[model samples]
Each structure stands twice: as C-alpha cells, then as structure tokens.
Target: MAGEQTGVGIADPALEAAAAPLLDKLVADGVAGKLAAQDPTLWGSDAEAEASIRLSWTTLHKSSRPLIGEIEALRTQLRSEGIDRVVLAGMGGSSLAPEVIAATEGVALTVLDTTDPGQVADALAGDLQRTVVVVSSKSGTTVETDSHRRIFAAAFREAGIDPARRLVVVTDPGSPLAELGEAEGYRKVFLADPHVGGRYSALTAFGLVPAGLAGADVARLLDQAALVADAIAADSADNPALRLAAALGAAHADGAEKVVLADTGSGIAGLGDWAEQLIAESTGKQGTGLLPVVVENKDAPGFADAGSDATPVAIGPATGAAKIAVAGPLGAQFLLWETAVAVAGRLLGINPFDQPDVEAAKKAARSLLDNPDALRGTAEPSAVIGAVEVYASAGTTGEGTLADVLREFLATAPEGGYLAVQAYLDRLDDASASLLRSELAPRAGVQTTFGWGPRFLHSTGQYHKGGHPNGIFLQLTGAADDDLDVPDRPYSLGTLQLAQALGDGQVLAEHGRPVLRLHLTDRAAGLAELMRAVQELAR
Candidate 1:
C-alpha cells in the first residue's frame, strides 16, 4: 500500500488512523485503479456478472449528459401545460436519490414510496390537473410504483386530464414499465441504463428523470459529481473513496461493525437515509455487513444509547465525537459513497452487487396477498395495552403495563446486538411515530434503526435476514382510517401494507430473530399510548 495522505475528503484523525492499514493494503493492491477501470474481478468471481453491468454508474457523469437536455425539455413542456407539481413513484434508490437531489437543490418533489392508504390518498389529493407523476421502477414490476401509476392514471382521468399527458415512466430499456408506458401512450418514457442497479443509480435516469422534471438542476448534479471523479478514482493513499472503504472495512474487521451515522448539521438533508440503503443492501449479506444506524441528529437518543463498540461516522461535517466524517456536495457524496461501498464489499468478502435475500420478504408478501390468511394475524392479540395489540413472536415481553412490556422486550436485545424498528404507518400523518427511534434507543441501549414499512423492506430488510443474526425487531402497524383500492388488484392498500409487515415479520421469526409485533387498533390513540409507554420506560 502507498504511504502518506493528500485528498481524504471523508476525513477524521481516529478514522484515518483506524483505516490506515486497510487503506495501505487497498492502495498497494491497486484496488482503486481496478475499480475505476470497472474490473469485475475486484469483488471476486461470484459477483462479476453484476459488478460488470453495475459499474456503468461510474461513467454516468459523462454518459448521462444527453439526459439533461431531454429532462429540461420535458420540464419546459410540463410548465407550458401549467403542470408544476411533480410526484415521484419509486422505491429504494429509485425514490431516495431523486428525493435527496430535489431536497438538497431546494426543489419540490412529492415522493410516494409507501403502501399506506392514507399516504397514497394524500399524494393523490393534490391538484391533479396541475401535477405530473413520474413513475420509476428498475424492474418495471415494483408493486408500490405500479399501484401509484394506476392511482395516478385514475386520478388524472377523473380530473378530465388525459393520463398520457400527465404521467411519465422511467425504467430500464425493455422493462415492463417501459412497455406499459409506450403502450399506454404516456407523455414520455425514459429508459434508464439497464447496467445500473436501483441502489447505485444516483447518476442515472432513476435519479435524474424525477429530479430534473421536478426542477432540480440535474445537470448541475452531474457537474458536481465530475469534480470529485478523479479524486475518488485515484489509487492514492488519500483517495476519499478508499478512505471511507478502509474505515468501514477495518471497523467491520475489528468487530465494531455497527455504523452509527448522523447528518452533522451538514447541508445535506437526507443523505444518511439514502446511504443507509446503499450500505445495508450492498454489503449486508453472507452473515456479515456494516449495519448503518442513522440518527435524526446529535441529540437523538441513539448518540447516547448505542453501545461504545459502534463506529461513529458523520455525513456532512465531522462532529467532535465522529471517528469518520464525509463532507461534500450531495452529488459528489453520492458517487463517493457508491464507490466506497463497492470497495468495502471486496474487503468484507461479499458480493456488493447482488442482494441475495431481498426476495424473501417479497415472496412472503405475495403469499399473504394471494392467500390473505397465510400468516394468520386475524386471531386475537396476545395482549392489549391501551390501544396497542401486542403479538410476541416467541417469548413473552411480560404482560403488564405497555411500558413494562416494552422494557422487557428491549431487555431481550442480545449483547452486541441491535434493534430494528419497522413502522408500517402513514409517515406524513404519523410522522411523530418516528420519535420512537430516539425514545427507544436510550431504553434499548443498542443501535436502533427506524424504517417506514414496505420501503425498508427494500432497504434494511435485506440486512435483517441476510446479515448477522444478532438483532431484535419491533414492528408497528396501524389500522388505516379509510383504505384505498389498488385499481384492479384484489387487495386494498391497507391490506397490502399489513401483509407486507406480517410477511416480513414471519420471515424474521423463521430466521430465529426475536420479533415484537404491535398493531395499532387506532392510529391516534395507539400512537399516544405507544409514546406514553416509551416515555415511561425512558423515565
């Protein structure tokens, strides 16, 4: 490995020190140069096929230049028609990158990535005549995006606007969505690079179309990424990408595998959330991967509660306590982290390009959607505390006050284990439900991760089942006040949402992971009771 340092953008003394040995070895082996050259052999033979195609994202800064003009033209056409609102329907990276790009650029892009009826209804309730929906899916078969497409088509038609005029589709070249959009006579059909995987597609159409159409300077993002392309690709001791890779690789190697992440007052709004999926789904397989614990802020309970063994990494500026810090423009950060994670995969002895376990939950959800009672949650709750119905997967969480039961459930977290909080509720209306992460983090005394349902199933859901088996799960689902239908599907949004939660829970239980499932019989009352219990436990 080469010695000395020059351009460590993700810099911190402790992290650099911890990463030095691995960074040296990576540099000595010419990993950076090989990865920059798109050498599939870098991640081993098993991952070569995926790595070959996926590496195209590295050149998108130049290859995607043509898209900027097309996107700008579409935006102009939409504006001419008095359509200013842009709603994006996608999942995981397809939705996250665009959301982050638009947010960082101070552009407004409504993102619909959930199966909650209330959330879907909220997205559809806006001015339909003045809104254009960008439906994006890599597979062209994502249930959530397809459902959003159908609902938008129906909503536009009801408003006397031709569906083809207001609905745009983005997908891989020959994907079902591409065909559907073409056949349906949509306003525009953007074919993303088939080589780009959904999670690593920040520089592709998956990240640009919705963002550009929503008014973010998608071209400027490419320019920002270009600024750091050389820095990331260089096989030097100071390569920022290798710096991050070393920190993650060495930390995982040293057994401090849990990565506790914060925004660090960085101008970036949702980078942690976006990077969470990248790290989790990319490396969280083969029974080992870095678990990203994203806290809301420095004040979040996770900062105080996550055990001392966790690796402290910040997104924007380095905080005093951070061992590693990644600071850059949102666009540059995207390319840097994607490259870093790919390199980290080599260090971790895993195939970064393949998500081998993501389909388990999907299959389970499909079974439940097909049979409805395959998992059987229709039975009476194991116990009721206020409006919360508790369903313990295995051992009891102590039948007492909700707070007492919560304390027992949290106490069950194994040594060095983490807590996964999966909430299947309307994120918009029940945004406060997210506070459970902060509240329960201190109580659980473990790195606590919170994810909205169906979406997380596409993100950390992979890690929960595929990575190390040392995690306890907390699932929260609510009774939708009023549910919406899926246009032609047999199931309603509420049913599909619940099925997704239950399906995931079943898989977790099957994997021998402890699960505490709570059903909110009433959204408002149940959340109130849940907070009351969590606060009491904290006290």
Candidate 2:
C-alpha cells in the first residue's frame, strides 16, 4: 500500500476491457490443464495442492484468509526454539518471493543470495545462537545455495553451535536437500512438493514470511491470494495481471524490446536483479524478447526511462521523484510487468521462470577457484589506449554490435576481482563491456583496479578521504543532458557534477595512479566508446 500510485496518465478503460477474454482463457486453461493435472506426489495430497493454490490466490487479491494449522504450527515451533532471524537461502525464484514477503512485512531477517566467500564470512560472523538458517531449493542441488550452505555450516561449527540447531531446510521431499536435511539430523525440515516449481512455491513457505513475521493471520493472506486466484480464474479482461500480460505481449510483438524494473528501497532493489534473471533466462530466446533491465530508482531515471517504450515497474514506497501515490498502483504495475513477461515468454515458446545461464557463471567461478593459478596467464596488464572504433550502423544494429563486443570482452577477461565501472550495466552493451572489463579483470597480477567513485565518494565522503586506498582507481564521468529536473534543493545535477569534481579524474590523479578521463556530450554513447577503448587497450 505504501508504494502504490495511480494516474500517471489517464487510464484506457477500453484497453483494459479488451484484455478480459484472454485472461479468462488463460485461467480456464491453467485450472483445467496445469493445476488440475498436477501429480499428487509432487504437491503432497490433493487437498494440500488446493490449499496452496487457494493461499496463493488469496494473497494476490489482498484478502485475509489465515494459513492453515500446519503452517501456524511450524511458525510457533520456530518461535519457541528462539529463532529471532530466519535466513531464506536460495537463488532466483526460490528466494525472490520470500524476499518480497520479508521486505513487505517489515520482519527482521537476512537473505544470503550470493555464493561469495566474503558474503558467507559475514553471515557466519553474525550471532548464530538466535539465527535460523532456512536452506531452500526445489531440486536440492542449486550449486550456489549448496556452496553457501557448506560455508555457513562450517561457520556454525566454528561458532560452537551444532549445525543442526541453526538449520531448517525447505526443498522437495525426496530431493537432495531433503535427504541431506534428514541425514544431517536437522532440527526441522519442510519439504516443498516436488511438483511445485521454485517460482510457484510462494503459497507455501515462499509466501509465508510476512504472515510469520507480523504474527498476521495467515488465513487472511491466503484469503487475499485466493481472491486473486478466483479473479484470475474468472478470465475477465478486468483481471489486472492478465491485462498487463496482454499489453506487454502486444508491446513486445510490436517491438518495444526492453523492460526496466525500478525500485527505491534496499529490500525491493534486489528484486530488480532477481527479475533480470527471470526475464532474461525465461524469454530471451529464438531472437525475440524484451531485454530485462534492472536498476535502483535512487532518483535517477537513466535506466528506467531510457528506451522509447520503457515501462517502469515501480516496487514499494515511492521514496524518490517518481511520486507514485499508492501501493495498489505499484501492485498493478508488478502484475502488469509479470503478465507482460509471461506473454513474452509465451510468444517465444519458453518458460518465463527458469534460468540456465545462471549456472554457467557459477561453474566458471567455481572452476576459477579450483585452479587459481590458471588466472595468471589470462590477466591483463594496465595500459593507456586510443579511441575505440565502431563498425556497426545506428540504432538496433548498433545495439547488437555493442552486445557482441561486450560478449567478446567478457569471454576473455580473467575470472575474479574488482574492475572499474565505465557505465551502468542496465543500459546498452558498451556500458556492460565497461563493467565486465572493470569488474571481471584477473586479480592474479594486477595491483589495483581503477574507476571513478562519484556515488561512493558522495555517500562515503569521510571514509574515502581518510581511509586507506588499497585498490586501483579509475574515474569516469561525462557532461550529458539531464533526463529529469530535480525539484528538491538537495537533489541537483550539480551534486553529481561536484562528486565528479571531487572524486573523478582529479581524485585518481591525486592518488598517483594511471588515471584516464574521457569527456563526451552523450553519457550512453560515451560509455560505449569508453568500453571499446578499454577492451582494445587492455588487449
């Protein structure tokens, strides 16, 4: 309710009405086909499946049905056991839904979505006595989740707490995680129905975070979700989710090829990243799909409003200049985007929820860890360069060229360590190439990574000015036309200008590192050029 807004532009009642028939068709098909045909073994009993669906639908509709007794029993058990913090450990859909619930419910919780050792170290460093680690995976073998679990378990052991005491696992009953949980003598384990895909598990523990936290009536949330289900089932064009899908589908069909997810708060900001994985993995196939772009809406419209047909799916309270008025609107926007993505996936004949490339990165990172010495040969030495040449024509063709260039650069970069940021990855390929070059460079031989620290410098002025500079620095900035006028006194373009002045080329110059400054009128184009130049220079 806090983040919803209405009437940025007048509502098209006619357009809304047109989508009803399709929504009806989809619901009927879903209930009669997917939901009805689901195997009992995968979802528990028939009654359990029905209950899960009802609960999911209810929450979507904002109703007040409480969760059934079994769920409540689990929550009570957790409370009685002195579990103050519940960690939902999973990746992608397995974790995103629960994350949304936790953020929305205002529960004190921490999520470990990354497999990075540093992240695991931080989690382990925290007080484990009161922590309940919920290791969630549908298949029981998400590489990242498993890796992090091992790290956390080792940490728990080091902290003197029995690993079982701090662990609760949610996974398919016969799956690896479930088997491991039982064998390891975990204190409690919740087995998700194998039939229910990770993305679709929200009705279960996936959507139970808010209910568990507020001690809110689970039944009520279930009721709300059930209402949504019923509405979806009815198949009327008035179904917001269905209509949204239709609108998004039409846009994609008509060639609006990018989706920009913008979020203001820390909790919801990560959702953008999750959405990126979802959309890209699910729909980007067969040469037709919206490139899912994710970015934090920190009063910056750079990524959100970039393309001509860019649609902003705003999440949670409008803390910035978007000035959205209601949570209902934000909810509507989400449903719209979800529908759009679903439709796009349908158009591409692909599943909108699964991500295959996600594992490749994990595998590569693991392999790099396995053979750290292999990185030495791949590492590139720092060097100055000249202007990068562009070979492609303008518009879409140019975008494709940039993407190819980025892929080529990333393919050759070393496995680990920080690189400089020339452009935000949410934008075009040139920016992505810059990021890949800066962040993915091999640390085997490099002494320092260079990049301008405008945002960090502004936010951490005291620390940067006084703290030790153990890393390399590269400063990048440009004079570009502003996308939006800042209305508040504190929000000025000059702030960025001053940040650049204080921390950009001159800042790196003072630190006595090899600093390079390239000024251009167009930020996006300039970023692209800088990326190409870096690749050529680094090569």
lDDT string, candidate 2, 312-358, tens digits:
44445444333121123223333333444544455444544434323
In model 2, which regions exceed 4 Å deviation?
2-68, 207-220, 263-274, 314-340, 353-356, 382-539
Model 1 alpha-carbon drift over 4 Å, by segment: 1-15, 304-306, 375-377
TM-score of each: 0.96, 0.58
Per-residue lDDT tens digits for candidate 1, residues 1-539, read 01112133444455567789899999999998888788989988888887888888888898999999999999998899899999999999889999888888888999999999999999898988789999999999999889888888888888888999898999999889999899989999999888878899999999999989988888878887888899888889878899889988877877887888887766877888899999999999999998999888765665534455577777766665667777777778888899999999999999998888889889988999999766454657879877899887688644888887788888888888999999999889989888888888877777889999989988898899999889999999998889998889988888889889988988998999999989999988999999988889754
lDDT of 1: 0.86
lDDT of each: 0.86, 0.44
Model 2, residue 509: what's the lDDT?
37
Instruction: Name the lDDT value of residue 300 in candidate 2.
Output: 35
| Residue 167 local lDDT, model 1 | 87
